[model samples]
Target: MALLREEDRQYLENLFKENLKDKVKIILFSDKAAGSKLVVPGRVECPYCQQTREILEELVSLSDKLELEIHDFLTDEIIAKKYNVDKIPAILFEKNNNVLGVRYFGIPSGYEFSSLIEDILDISRGETQLSPTTKAFLATVNKPVHIQVFVTPTCPYCPRAVRLAHQFAMENPLITADMIEAIEFPHLAEKYNVTGVPKTIINEKVEIEGAVPENIFLEYFKSALKD
Candidate 1:
């Protein structure tokens, strides 16, 4: 009684194959009983939840380079608390005690799926394709940079912003990037004044709306560093 349809499974298999070419470990935190906490009533089962698990398990079984770990949030309170995971299906990519990248909420599916794969590649390679100038600027950054990018599922340009923020977080241990679904996290959207898609809030001070190139993103990072 798997949730995934055959077509979806095949599609996901192809995606996993294309994305995971090197060793990558995915730690998936989920609760069998609890639905997505971000959703209301807390009783509705996510249609994609079980299917996502199946897809990850299939990828793990087929690929020697990919390792998948699942934890029930109800049974593993300690681990969940340690990771400070408040959302369901949080994906963490770690290597050698260093948290290379984290997807705070759910799977980055739909158009964001490509962004998720890019994140895996970046973590696996231990490098991002950001320009040298961007790297040089980020290298001098010492303080914690928390970036929250608000996006919708249908937005085409949102992934670029999320990827850039994730790249920053992956390169710098002090940087943490969160991809917030505006509709899913309504309160957060209101709190951050997110009236448009791809709104990026850095360290609660500097805010940039719309998708921009890497250099523009770097400029905002620099401004946030000063605050």
Candidate 2:
């Protein structure tokens, strides 16, 4: 069974066909034993890695401009450290071989699927749909800003928050945005105290509890930059 329905696949095919202007490389880190029940000693299990790669494989199949690269997180410690990926089922995108700061820390299924596609389109077009004001602000960011938006697959409001953070990353190289599936990484979620959906943490300092308007989010983002 495919993760994406046939009808939805057709829609995305058309979408990517019409919009993609540059090639987008999708990078994934996973283990092969994820889909199996076999136990591997001394290695922590990654439950969703296999399914995540499968969905990405299906996704790249929909568009000629999209590519997928899979890596074993256990054996590829150097590569994982290079990308700062500490978790399994991690995903990131690149264009013209330039890796973006945007990342997905779990399966980009459910509502977040749309966010994934939007990021690809934005990367392919070398542009974002953020307000001009927001883009201008992002360009002036000098310090490293890390934005982590905690979300669940079922949350309807999470995509907006995730998309906004990702677009911010695209606008500025110093900014890194991550979409963390709260249910999958309970330890990090607990550390951050993610009690609700659409919780966004910026610079691991500023926290936004809900999905705020674009301008409102900008205000919070600025606060994160303040000393």
Candidate 3:
């Protein structure tokens, strides 16, 4: 059975045709290719890796402008390190060979699917929906800003936080935004004390609970820099 319904596939095809501009490359660092027989040291069992690859494969087939590249996180250690990817089922968006800081560290299903789609569109257009004021502020970011939005697939408000972080990443290469599925990565969720959905951890210091407006998110982003 197809993960995406036929109706959803058709909708995405039409949507990509209308909105996608430049070519967008979808890169995934996963152990899916290794299958169950192979075992690499330090690499744990990835229950969602295969499903994640299947979804991404199905997604890229919708548009000619979209490309998919799958790399084994263990075998392709050098490549993973280059992209700062240390986890399985990690997704990255690339345009013109430039992999911006927009990354997804889990299976983007349920409501998180919208965040993945919008981020791809944003990368294709090489622009973001953030306000001019936000853009101006992003331009001044000389330091690195890591925004990790911990989410669950069922969270209705998670996409808002994820998309905003992704758009901020698109605005500035120094800002790396990641959407982490809390259920899939329970250890991380516990590490960050993610009790609620749409909890955003910036630079491992600033934490924002719930989905807030763009201005409020930016304010939190600014505070993260001060730390």
For each candidate, give its TM-score against the true structure.
Answer: 0.82, 0.97, 0.96
In the predicted model 2, the residue pairs found to clash are none
Over the full model, what C-alpha lDDT does candidate 1 score relative to the true structure?
0.75
Q: By how many angstroms RMSD does model 2 differ from the true structure?
A: 1.0
Give the per-residue lDDT digits (tens) of candidate 1, residues 1-227: 55457786677667657765557778777766544446535343444556557656765665566788787765787987887666666677777556554564655666776776678777766788999888887787788888988888788999999999999988788888988777766778899899999899999999999999998889888888884
Q: Specify the highest-lDDT model's number.
A: 2
RMSD of each candidate relative to the true structure: 3.9, 1.0, 1.5
Residue 179 in model 1: shift from native, Å? 1.5
Alpha-carbon local distance difference test for all models = 0.75, 0.92, 0.92
**Candidate 2 lDDT tens digits, 1-227:** 78888999999999999999999999998886687777887565788888899999999999889999988888888999999999988999888878899999998989998899899999999999889999998989988999999999999999999999999999998999999999999999999999999999998889999899899999999999999
What would the per-residue lDDT of candidate 3 be over residues 82-170, giving only the tens digit for each residue? 99997778999889889999999989999999889988888998888899999999999999999999999999999999999999999
Q: Candidate 2 — worst ten consecutive residues by lDDT sum?
A: 35-44
Q: Rank the candidates by TM-score, best first.
A: 2, 3, 1
